[model samples]
Target: MKMVIVDKANEGKKLFRYIRTLAPSMKNGEIFMSIRKGKIKINNRIEDQGYILKNGDVVKIFFPDEIIKKYTDNDRNKYRSIDSNIDVIFEDKDIIVVNKPAGILVHPDRREFKKNLVESVKAYLYKKNEFKPGDYFTPSPCHRLDTNTSGLIIFAKTHFALQKISTLFRERNGDKLYLALVFGKISSSILISSSIDASENKENKVAVKEAHIHNFIPEKSKFIEENPTLSATYVRPLKYDSRLSLVEINLWTGKKHQIRASLAAALHPLIGERKYYTSQSLSLSQMLNVSNYYLHCYKLKINGYEEFKAPIPKKFSQILSEMFKIDAAKL
Candidate 1:
């Protein structure tokens, strides 16, 4: 008999899947038959294949050494060379918050990019021995950020945390603040509400239409298009001159490119924004050497949890100083 102790990595995994990872050569019929014959036990008690594993649970498999050895490969050794380059903002037993830099993907989009935020985070925990190889469950991110957008993002260290944090995001029970540098000076706070249709281009681009308010009817407003998602953003100028302005945004609704598209409709596209850039904004970007939009998720607060903030990037600060002639540190 061979014994394995369930660690944090395997903590919420099912017994059947975990066993398959351990002994890859075992056929499906053989595994089910083994479980039925009491060939596998958890904590010295016979359990079904569907049993969910918990940390420190001892699993006993009455399999021959040759059966285990011939099939299982070195899954851990393949990840040994991965090193984390993440900037940690907060960490706890259940979750980790990181400052993802601009240009790195939170998750890989294609096969060409091997290094990403998820791999880096796993490697960080792997070094601490909190995670092990050949486990059914892996550490996962609770949210995502655009590849060119730099900001704070959260990763759940355990299965329980992943479920809870994901629920919070889905319910929109958290507050998120974004900082953006845009063209034109604005005086007062404005709320931009529009309908965004992403079905046309397979999410590569989105079309925005304004929500029209009717004077003929009571104070009711509706989107003109059918089945398009409605999105709203509250934009307030923080500091601005005649030519440029720095703004803070409270995204009332989360949609793909809600901020970027909404602002472009308002004729104040973000500096260096590619997908939603205006001619004037594009000209300014060329003058300022800005390649991508300056949009950062500066602050986030879960409804019941403490607020977390990520500092503005150095490149963002430099642009503010040179364009607006205002000190970013003071803002």
Candidate 2:
């Protein structure tokens, strides 16, 4: 039998949700069945899956230790050598905001074995004695940025903070601003309200339909009806040259590849973007010998929270100066 005590980090989480995090190897059906069969109990009482966990509650799972250990999070052991040099923008008791450089994955996948942002954050917190190994709830990012997109990403230090921040993001109760250098010149501000089809995604790239003048309309087409998502991007041209435009993007919908695909649909693909760009933009990117995309999440503000901004990366700033003759610091 394995037992877990509800802590502040896991407080307010549903029983089923808490179980999935504790025993990750167990399938959903198995968890439901185990709960139904009285194999799981909270405070020595059988509770439904939807029961909200509270601090000091004791959860018991009548499963073998070996089975529970086999599927639990073992990332701490996997990453012995931790990189603690994280660029922290703002940190408080509840949350930490860091600037993620381009070329690092936020979360590790099967193909990624090296240290990622999560590991780095954990290592940093561990060094400060704020986090401990074998803790059921580890600090995690509230949202994700693309691997090549450099900028501010927030991590929740507590479970209560995670729940609150996640709700803010889900309800779009905050503003996220991105800065980019797109290929074509944008004369004025443009609002691109388009629907993205993930079902049609190929090679890790999603398809964005033509922008509509009105608000997003649900996908009625049979081909992409299964996984269509609404997206809106407000592009304000900050500065422009003959070939490229420095633009500030106000993202209304945080869908996958929303900024890249939406700009491509508007004929103003971001410089250095590998996917969702015209052939001419690709040629220009090749000529410039760019290593990563030029999109950066520059600013973020949650409702009733202090606004946070990440300074532009040195390379990103240098590139802008060399290409457009505009100093990024001034903007």
Candidate 3:
């Protein structure tokens, strides 16, 4: 199996409820039976029928590794679509950098999310007989992007690279870039140093001062955030049409939604944001049918390796040219 951590948001829920969150396809009764069979354990120890779960508790799932692997392979083939548009910026013995498109899962989420970039990458590599650890079974993405945020995501080829790249991202040494179409105009790049607070009630709120995050979401492997860190980004106006302006941004910190949150805080929320709504300007939210925002991870620089830059994906640049008659190539 797999391991699940009860996040702070799931604190008050019952153990069975928490189990349901782990695998929605399985019922509570089924989970109960599994627990009885010694398959489910709480905090790395076996759980009885009465075992209670709370926030930050580790839930270990012990089943045959082969079975879990099979489940992943089957689901990848069955659920997520195959996209030929996945752009590879660079690949070496240690790492791979790729341009992820919008409207796809970077990984599977049980919340009715579609299959994503990692699976597509695996399939591509497998088809080319390129699967390996130092050589078969490279690690999954050491980091992630938001479901609606299109950008560059890095994958590690070996355990050593995974560790090094992981540390680099944690130290905020990597360069992250995004291009966005927002509703209004700004004289220059505006960086908002806001603090994000998450309550036990699972609500996330923003504070102007630095706020420390007591992570309740216990990820198997975690990426760390330095609270009140120097989160900087450079934004330059690419072009402006009647209403929206296309801006390119490079972030200094890898906070959860750094670019999105900061931009929205500056009254330039993403052009098609539905969750983080902005009222100061018009967004594509009221416009034609679409499922994603207009931000693209145009480039990523990890550990000063700026050997190449990922060009803006077609959907993002094309939207600018088509909707506003502004070409994004000049950026």
- The clash count for each model shown is 0, 0, 5
lDDT (Cα, tens digit) per residue for candidate 3, span 246-307: 78776655566666666666666777776555754443557644446788777776765764
- Which residue pairs overlap in candidate 1's backbone? none
Candidate 1 ranges with C-alpha deviation above 4 Å:
1-74, 200-203, 211-229
Q: Per-residue lDDT of 213-281 in model 2, one digit per residue for the tens?
A: 423333323312442465777788888878889899987767888889888888888888888889989
Worst 10 residues of 1 by lDDT: 212-221
How high a TM-score does candidate 1 get? 0.74
Q: Give the candidate number with the greatest lDDT.
A: 2
lDDT of 1 by residue, 37-112 (tens): 8898899898999999999999988878776554444445545777666799998988988988888888856668
What is the alpha-carbon lDDT for the whole of candidate 3?
Answer: 0.63
Using TM-score as the measure, the top candidate is 2
What candidate 3 gets wrong by more than 4 Å, as runs, is: 1-85, 132-138, 198-231, 282-291, 322-325
Work out how many backbone clashes candidate 2 has: 0
Local lDDT at 9 for model 3: 42
Q: What is the lDDT of residue 255 in candidate 1?
A: 82
Model 1 residue 120 CA deviation (Å) reads 0.4
TM-score of each: 0.74, 0.81, 0.63
lDDT-sorted candidate list, best first: 2, 1, 3
* Candidate-wise lDDT, in order: 0.78, 0.81, 0.63
Query: What is the Å distance of residue 63 in model 3 from its true position?
Result: 10
